[model samples]
Target: MSFEFEKELRVTETNIPGLLVFDLPVHGDNRGWFKENWQRAKMTALGLPDFGPVQNNISFNATKGVTRGIHAEPWDKYISIAAGSIFGAWVDLRPGESFGQVFTTRLDPSRAIYVPRGVGNSFQALEDGTVYTYLVNAHWSLEQKRTYTFVNLADPELDIRWPIPLEESERSEADLHHPMLRDAKPMAPKRTLVTGCNGQLGRAIRQYAEAHGLEGFEYTDIDEFDFSDPNAYDKYDWSLYGTIINAAEYSTELCDDTDNADKAWRVNAQGPALLARVAAEHHIVLVHVSSDAAYGMNKESKTIAPVSLYGQTKAAGDIAVANAPEHYVLRFDAETLQDSEQCAKEVFRLLDEHTAYGIRDFS
Candidate 1:
């Protein structure tokens, strides 16, 4: 029902926010040591999300140098060691200030770690017959999960270190083919067409991407892309941009006007549809940045039902993106919208079919 980890648990905050460590006080006698791993009322009083563990998992590694992990779930987790030790590593996937940052710790029988949602996690066993247990608030979904079993610990971009050398660490088939973080980004295009380049959002994106090593982005302006034009798709060589970020939009306020409604439908709706088609034709993945306004004021709806005309057009665009063969529609709230840096990082993660996108929903 509840876990009281406060009294016996020592909490430590790492560089990454929300990722915490819990150290258990062990009382040892002539026989052995004893510790309480879970306490309900204690943890709840600390104002933390009452982590009602829905699943309990245990992994036993038979020999030393055995490794398992780089996996994360949709819910937060509490991991404890039953025997031996492990080098556990996790990356925050949430789209805020700490996005894409990694944290690593040695977890033994006396320690546990709390992993937040939207994070990439993994670990390695240091000794044979090493066992660890997990208390998670969510269930496992093979189709919709993003945990990697074999990650390149030697990847320069990740810069993660293991107890053993990179060559000594065992790896799985999936890890061997995984792309490096530096090479994993989709914006690595030789030719990228960035719409709305002159606008604030566009300028911010351009600045952030350039600073973050996103090369080959051919930032295009309103002067270039006339999506309403029937020949718009023919004007450019779409092959180079294997990934397209459709950042252009006809603002919601403009769409409210009757005179501008047609402009809105053509640019906001038809424009995105055309982009998706072009991307599909070229076998490229289209990323359409839509407005969360499409959900209207209700953010928890399972379907789109917007009271505003602007939301309606954005929804049309989102639908088009969703219908495309390969695409991702990103709906961002205006007020809480992340800065361009976060957006750039997210775009990179989205492109890496091995990282966040790698977690699929087979079920």
Candidate 2:
């Protein structure tokens, strides 16, 4: 199937003005199809959003480059590879920002990269067919988005350097003359909040944050806050946070026991509803983690499929959270062990026992 990819930029530069929309038409045939690489008039007519590009250009790479980018400046770009493959990466040089982070993804003929404004980015061609295209939010006047060769590793103020030489060309040579390289400025920090801190998943998230050296996060676990309690929303400060990872849930194992269904509904369904409602009211990005058991009984009911009350209630919970606008639900399965033996070990043990006792045959 063919798809159309487009984007509207919302920024202003010294060389370009107003909203700009960039779109590419993708066509498909028996041996694959073609697309309009870039059209200036079509974009202008589409009423480009905010920032528009004044010039368009393309690059061809013959080999993988050494010492590629982990760099950024006060510019934004939309990049796509028309052919070949490369490992594209970006580092938040936005300085002091909370998610001033590093992200990397592979760019092939199938994928594109949207490097945000002010983020440093670079890539290395993996094959001979590599063609890189970029749309800058600003026009190329004196050549922008350039950085000092050793600013990150040399300057006592910034101390930046490249372990190897950059892949240089006429385009890069022109950018070396920009003024931003002479006086670099630091960026402000960002803050994030995490919800559902006390549950097993919450604890794991906390552990990951600590391991990754993430700071400025306000953690709210079950011990500190209870979603089941109606008044739980009043005690906390909601304005300081922007993201909420909802790891709260009712354990599904209870479905195996013959208990009142109302209790299950309250915890599995109503609890998440309350949290999501509060998140929407506060404008927080809620990440709701769910379970795959919600898919219900499959053909292999005795094995891979879940045929229990827990699965049904979890499915209901999934629907509830999805209805909330500011909520994101992620469903997955997990296994845990109380002793040295895990669930896999127990499954194997039971299988071996069944075979030994003639309950099943290995052959």
Candidate 3:
């Protein structure tokens, strides 16, 4: 028997963003066949995300008509068949324009698919002992499992044509009871939350995000997310955001009175402390621009002196923000900080560098 497979590996994009299909090279001889199921170096060079897979799982289906899944988990997955063959189906269940997009294909040893987080994955075994193997970037747990978004495999609107009728296919009771596409809750993608949107830095970040065609960002000011108000924490879903850029701060003239100092402390120090606490609990990345007060100060002075009440409060806020494990405390001199546009560019450039947690000076 003459069997043929692709001589080189290649990838194809699907309707869903980040979802990719790979055609692998399979070597065959009389003794059977062998294939490089996953070559990280080569795959990464071919547009594949270097998704640091920490867990690997395998499922064996004993019957030809067995079916499983249609689950959109929180972590990305790279799936392929190790033995036999299967029919695969994927759906974009992430919140956005392509929420209901679907893609279907067949997979053998020579075929693989990269399923981005928030994309549902399912398959039917076309042969007995069909082995489905996948690598996930995150370790699985019961708590994480509850976050999975699921859709019924038999949803008529999805119109997935299963070779074997669902009635004849074996499936878990849970899989059979999933909500339809219309009723299913779309998985929330990691979002960028820009606080103090009306401020110079916040406004700049918003404009930068827009001009650069960045998506999944939400801008908010004191009206929506007053970090100074403890009750404000209850108003928003913090889990939806992966990054929070804090540009909110108290700006007031030098004052010696108790009332003014109290107000400054609450807005500058306490507010950031609260935000940092929440961010730390959620493992969210925090980007805070510490006092831009370097306005007209003598640049030659190397001493760390905060003479004004406002300056002291801003310093306290910076210290509080540094408590978060994943944080970027950015400090800019007067010129750059005042130029919101340039400051925004510098901020984004630092973010693109993926710098570790620490203070960054763009002075």
Best by lDDT: 3
Q: Estimate each model's TM-score.
A: 0.47, 0.41, 0.62
Stretches of candidate 2 exceeding 4 Å from the true structure: 1-192, 258-263, 298-307, 334-363
Judge candidate 3 at residue 147 and give its lDDT.
78
Write model 3 residue lDDT over 96-195, tens digit each, in one string.
7888999999998889999988999999999999999999876776756767899999999999999989999999989989999999998765678888
Alpha carbon lDDT of each predicted model: 0.67, 0.51, 0.81
Q: In model 1, which runs have C-alpha deviations exceeding 4 angstroms? A: 1-8, 146-151, 183-363
RMSD of 3: 8.6
Return the candidate ranking by lDDT, descending: 3, 1, 2
Better of 1 and 3 by lDDT: 3
Of the candidates numbered 1 and 3, which has the greater TM-score value? 3
Candidate of highest TM-score:
3
Tens digits of per-residue lDDT, candidate 2, 1-363, equal 124333232222211121122334456657875665544465434543223444455778766552244455334466767877666655455443322344555655445555544565566666665788887654443323232121231223323333223433212433343223235444322235555566555666666667667665567755677665678878855443445666666676665675757666766777677777766554445566666677665524522344567777777777777655555555555434222123223332332343110011211
Rank list by TM-score: 3, 1, 2
